[model samples]
Target: MKRRLLLVSNSTLHGGGYLQHCQQQIQDFFGKEVKRILFVPYALHDRDAYTKTARDKFKTLGLCLYHMDVEHTVTATVIFISDVLFFSLFPGYEVESVHETPDPVDAVRKAEGIFIGGGNTFRLLKALYDNKLVTEIKKRVLEDGIPYMGSSAGTNVSTISINTTNDMPIVYPPTFAAIGLVPFNINPHYLDPDPNSKHMGETREQRITQYHEELETPSVLGLREGSMLLVEGNKATLLGSTKARLFQRGKQTTEYEPGSDLSFLLTDAQ
Candidate 1:
């Protein structure tokens, strides 16, 4: 069976519509057989709420939820054990939580589908690369047919390289070597309606334009809110209401709507 990679702009558990978007896509694609595993590294503050809410939402969606241990292996083990106990003692499905020890390379490789939660995607990419898990994750997606999904940082990491991010640049260039699952770089949380013009920070479009000019070779996709790219096999198609703008070095700047071909940028420099 072929696997599907679903990357979101952010973890939608905290009221962003991204999570809901992910749910709909999964439902549409996998239907009742959808199984989700959330890789959370930054949801410590509201751990309980996030977990309960995710379980409830998936239940409503008629999907099964599995959570990986984010910190303190014992806590994760406890959650997994408790779930096992519930399944053994009670009557629901078997939902397990595993302690995320020695990184998640093996686990990611084995999963049918994985979701990279929104937070500091750079940080996640850095850790994955440092631990040498990014390569394994990519191998799983490309070679072994595992469906991988990421939001915000997750979405950014799916690109050839992530140049557009709201977080301060803490990771180095080599560490930012993304999964390259898609041909173009992704600028999530993108915006173009900023006519107000008072904010000191560059608008999403402004930042991407600046990056494009500075790079020796650049191919960028500035994706705004509620926008995503659905990549299958070697081809990709833009999804959602917003238009996906492509910027490249040698080609005329063009904006494409959903269902258009993105393979051109793959051969284009940068």
Candidate 2:
């Protein structure tokens, strides 16, 4: 099956609610068929608390969030190996830790939709590798045609590698390799160079330049604030008012406008 993904640059815009910017587009992506959501809050520090807050956001869009098996009845049991999450029995529609589930991967596979929250990219990748859930999530989204959405650091993981991310490496993961759900990489929360800046720090563009020098094969897209990439089947379009920057190896970096044809941006990396 073709991949169905939504990569958001950022979840909240300043004073806006969590994911309030893309709520309409997000709801439209899953539509009415999606009843359950596999919320992966590994990126954030307090995943348990985040899960409760995340469930509330889903409720705002008139949707319930929970993960269940194929039988339609909630019966799977959870046992968390760490205190990161508390396990809960599948008594009814409720939010719990991903690792707490009996079969973490299987639960993800069975869910109608998957939601990955934004936080630290390194910590998130480490958690995924630790729990051996990287492959399971890939199988569910890429093969099963499940709807997936991620913002900021969450969006960075959707690509082949997290090399292009703007976050610091607070924790070292097994590898810089990510989900590889998308063919290329993304630098979310991309800040354009300011003409009046006199500070000595390198701009976002300059930093990405350093990244390109290291791995020139993988293309990187700089997703600015409030911008997102909505992928349907083979097509990936830029959704929002602002434009996005695209950096290709040995090619001049170009800016992609909103509503423009972005079907070719999803091509495989060289």
- Indicate which candidate wins on lDDT: 2
Query: TM per model?
Result: 0.72, 0.85
- CA lDDT, every prediction? 0.59, 0.78
Query: Distance (Å) between predicted and true CA of 113, model 1?
Result: 1.2
Query: In candidate 2, what are the lDDT values of residues 27-102, reduced to their tens digit?
Result: 6776657767788889999877888888777765633222221133433222122211321222222344575578
Model 1 local distance difference test score: 0.59
Q: Model 2 clash pairs?
A: none
- Cα RMSDs of all predictions? 10.0, 10.5
TM match of model 2 to true structure: 0.85
Question: Considering summed lDDT, which 10 consecutive residues are worst modelled in model 1?
Answer: 90-99
Error of 2 at 105 (Å): 1.7
Candidate 2 accuracy as lDDT:
0.78
